[model samples]
Target: MAEPVRVRRLTDQEGQRLRQIVRRGSIHAVRYRRAMMLLASGGGNGVPVIAQLVAAGEDTVRDVIHRFNEIGLACLDPRWAGGRPRLL
Candidate 1:
């Protein structure tokens, strides 16, 4: 079986930043969701519980946690391809 995923330990600054985003309610919805996931994980909630609390799929919660572990707070706003792909 695969090991469960979780966000790494958060510094005081990172924790404060996430709380600000969640409290202000002005950040992008996607970022808000990601921040919530990391905060819940840091608070000791497992992937499944976090998914239910956030009303998201288990896979999505897992992805957010893993992404946060890899990129820290930057995972909140991901950079995706903006333009259409060209046929090679």
Candidate 2:
């Protein structure tokens, strides 16, 4: 049997902060934070549960968690730097 994905626990402060974001209904940060909280709380703790809850794909949920873990809140906003500029 394959090992299940380990769910990360959110501190009380983190949980509260995430809840606030969800309540604000920003239509931007809310979705991301909600997913983060769900994942952290072991809600579906897998690709399918997260996808169903957030109406996104498994890959998306996985990416979001990874980005948040890597860069903190900045992950909420996607950054497109565009391709490398050509040096003339």
Candidate 3:
């Protein structure tokens, strides 16, 4: 069997910070933070485990992890790039 992915553990302060984010952040942000926390803490280390825990797809979990690793916390926010600009 393939070795399971190793997850980094969050510090107590980091856990508290994540809880605060989940409590006060926007819907998208909260969801992402919660998932990240779960994954980071080994609550669910693999994509399948995380997906089942969060009721999200494996791809979604992978994407969130990748985004957070690459871009820090800002990836939690849902950015809707504005539609095409109107010509003056």
Candidate 4:
């Protein structure tokens, strides 16, 4: 079987930051949701549980976990490119 998707061990600072975001809330909903996902995963929750907890899709939870594992806390706020591409 494939390994379960999970967040890696969080550093002290990363844990604190995630907690702060969850406790205090963030201006960006994405940040808040991502933080919650990470915290839940860190707390040993599974992807489905985290998804239900945050009212998000399991894929989203998995993506956040994967992103967090790959890029640490930076996954909290994704850089989405907006607007149509310019054809010069």
RMSD of 2: 4.7
Error of 3 at 35 (Å): 4.6
Task: Tell me the spans in candidate 2 whose CA falls farther than 4 Å from its real position.
Answer: 27-45, 82-88
TM-score-sorted candidate list, best first: 4, 1, 2, 3
Per-prediction TM-score to the true structure, in the order listed: 0.85, 0.62, 0.58, 0.91
Q: Pick the candidate with the highest TM-score.
A: 4
What tens digits encode model 1's per-residue C-alpha lDDT throughout 1-88? 9877878889999999999999997458988888889899999999899999989999999888888888788889967878988889
Model 3, 1-88: lDDT tens digits are 9655434565686566666665665367556555454445356567777677667777666676666666655556667689999899
Q: 73, model 4: CA deviation in Å?
A: 0.9
TM-score of 3: 0.58
Q: Tens digits of per-residue lDDT for model 4 on 1-88? A: 9899989999999999999999998989999999999999999999999999999999989998999999898888779899999999
After superposition, the stretches of candidate 4 with alpha carbons farther than 4 Å from their true spots are 85-88
Candidate 3 backbone overlaps, count:
0
lDDT preference between candidates 1 and 4, better one: 4
For candidate 2, write residues 1-88 as lDDT tens digits.
Answer: 9655434565676567666666666577646554454545354456676667677776667777666666655556667589989899
The worst-scoring run of ten residues by lDDT in candidate 1 lies at 25-34
Error of 1 at 41 (Å): 0.5
